[model samples]
Target: MDSVKLGLKENWKQFALLVIVNGFVGGMVGMERSIFPQFAEVEFGVASKTAILAFITAFGISKAVANYYTGKLANKFGRRTLLLFGWLLAIPVPFMLIYAPSWTFVIIANILLGLSQGLTWSSTVVMKIDLVGEKDRGFAMGLNEFAGYFAVGIVAFITGYVANSYGITPYPFYIGVFLSIVGFLLTLFWVKDTRDFVKKEGKNNKTVELKNVFLETTFKNKTLSSVTQAGLINNLNDGMIWGLLPMVLFSLNFDNENIGIITAIYPAVWGIGQLFTGKMSDHYSKKGMLFWGMLMQGIAILFIPYSSEFAVLAGLSAILGLGTALVYPTFLATIAQATSPQQRAESIGTFRLWRDLGYAFGAIISGVTADIFGVEYAILTIASLTIMSSLIIKFRMPVNIKTVRK
Candidate 1:
């Protein structure tokens, strides 16, 4: 334990490796993001919006369950074990996507993708937190999320372009095969468990461990629950974008390449903005970041429904991404600050359980609402819910504008 060092500079090599590994994780999601809805509508003849989005529901629910368990199981089985085991699930995904003759197989593939994401993404997150300790936690989260989401942005554009050039089936999905293999080999060969870092940090950590991690993270603690609800709302809106944005752009006559660029812009801005937002959290007020961030996202979502021009929509997406960037790292950093080292993993899992559920609820709600009320109404509904979430954070979470970080 005496040999353990706890700072980003000290763990740069491992941290860099984990960042690259997480990029692969986000790339997995990217492969499906920009084109799946189009694929369903075109290939499978599934025109019902709700039916097309069932894959996201499956992904959300499965990922939520896996996230909950990953936290409970992390310390017991070891992080590396959970990570390697997750890759096993990913190996079959691209093949499943490429060959599926029916919609059911696509749903099954997303289920696998969600589970693999839960385990692998959760492990990398926990491991990075374990590695960096206290000094640069927010920056570490920023870099971590940036790597993952930026990958999502990049892959989305590539696949969208590829799908535009070569008919959307075998070619775009080929990237998934390469990513899964590289991600797996990297984790198996180079990734190390962070249990030792946890042990080291725990020795000096004085924050009180929660009596019940789930209850407190979910509802009992005002500060934690505030952050938790904001996370759910963030992802909820994101799910809406994931499941519907392409369809909306198509309704306006934009092609796949354009839809891909518009879709990628939001996450690209989100990924890049976090590089600064994360560091800002360390120097500035987290509460302000959360409040304004959610507000910005809400405003952007509301505007999205009104935009018909390509540049206007793209600009709105960037604003939305920037808003999300403001809060994404802050959410994790706040969670880490509020909880003790002893139960951090479970607390994070509990928070993510509800957060990922937003994806399902968003997909289901938006899908059904779009089917019934129209796409505009569906967008309006999510945007309203997002604003309400921002208000919760503003009123419930305590203001901590003066806290300083080195």
Candidate 2:
């Protein structure tokens, strides 16, 4: 514990920068959750339902491709360089949205945003694992997630307000541009390379072949495979929440602020609750943590359709957040524990690829369901899927009941 504390103190500045950049990245991705449906409707003259589906499809496909490549890029160019480049690529996203001449342009922006998300956000997770080492990994991951999702919640609310007040739907994208540029500059100037950590493990001599890395070690690890499956379900629900929640609230005739508050709670609670959950995972069973977290998330999803009032919906959102809080870091911890240091980036990258693919799948599935059956039914359908996912993990994954001895 003392050693962990010392490492944290030694690297606090870099961690802080990482938190800021990660948070901004999260906010940039999440900002459109509340407003994009309207943007498609108002700006592009498309049907609300069709535009939402288009946006989700674009993001999902782009992110999946980017995730596949980001690990290799990080390995070849170094984590810091890829991280910086990802943010730099994001600088034009908001400008494109704000000035988009057509719905096609919005699709282009989402593609770029997806690429940025996969490269930057995925790298941050791997980087944190590299910096913190195994013993203190859960806490580090929690802190990282807390920063990212807190920014998501706060920025969602603020952007909702901006959109409502100014009647300009593109304002949030403008904010994304500013934040991405700042984050890019910070990465370029402040963040350090983590390749040294892998070198310390004496595996630096292994040649990195981008093509076969995903098919090789990453897919073969039992623990990583379990977490990857779990991550898919977890992120599928996340995609549903982000892609459909605002549409749900809008259907309920809630104001933009209400939508913002509700949308914010899911990630905020997930983020804040991780402070304790991550620590608990470090001292307890990672699989158990994941199981219970998924269970809670499943139960929480069951409540969403039933909660029509603002406060009730907010409470349910927090519940969903708690479930998310418990599972995300545990999944990351499992990946760290399961892989060799030399393979961690590739493993993390592959893990993210499957997880983000869930987003693509979730978005399309939930979007079509919502379009056909209504958003409430879509929420219920996803809740059922979450329940099934929890059952699968509970039965199939190894439940690490023993903790690492200090």
Off by over 4 Å in 2: 1-6, 48-50, 202-220, 401-406
What tens-digit string does per-residue lDDT give for candidate 1 at 1-406? 7888998999999999999999999999999989999899888999998999899999999998888899999999988999998888998999999999899999999999999999998899889999998778899999989999999999999999999999889999999999999999999999999999998988877787788999999998888899999989899999999999999999999999999999999999999999999998888889999999999999999988889999999999999999999999998888888887768899888888889988999999999999999989999999999999999999988886222222
Deviating ranges (above 4 Å) for candidate 1? 401-406
Q: Per-candidate TM vs. native?
A: 0.98, 0.91
Give candidate 2's TM-score: 0.91
TM-score attained by model 1:
0.98
Alpha carbon lDDT of residue 29, candidate 2?
73
Model 1 lDDT on a 0 to 1 scale: 0.91
Q: What is candidate 1's CA lDDT for residue 156?
A: 97
Worst 10 residues of 2 by lDDT: 202-211
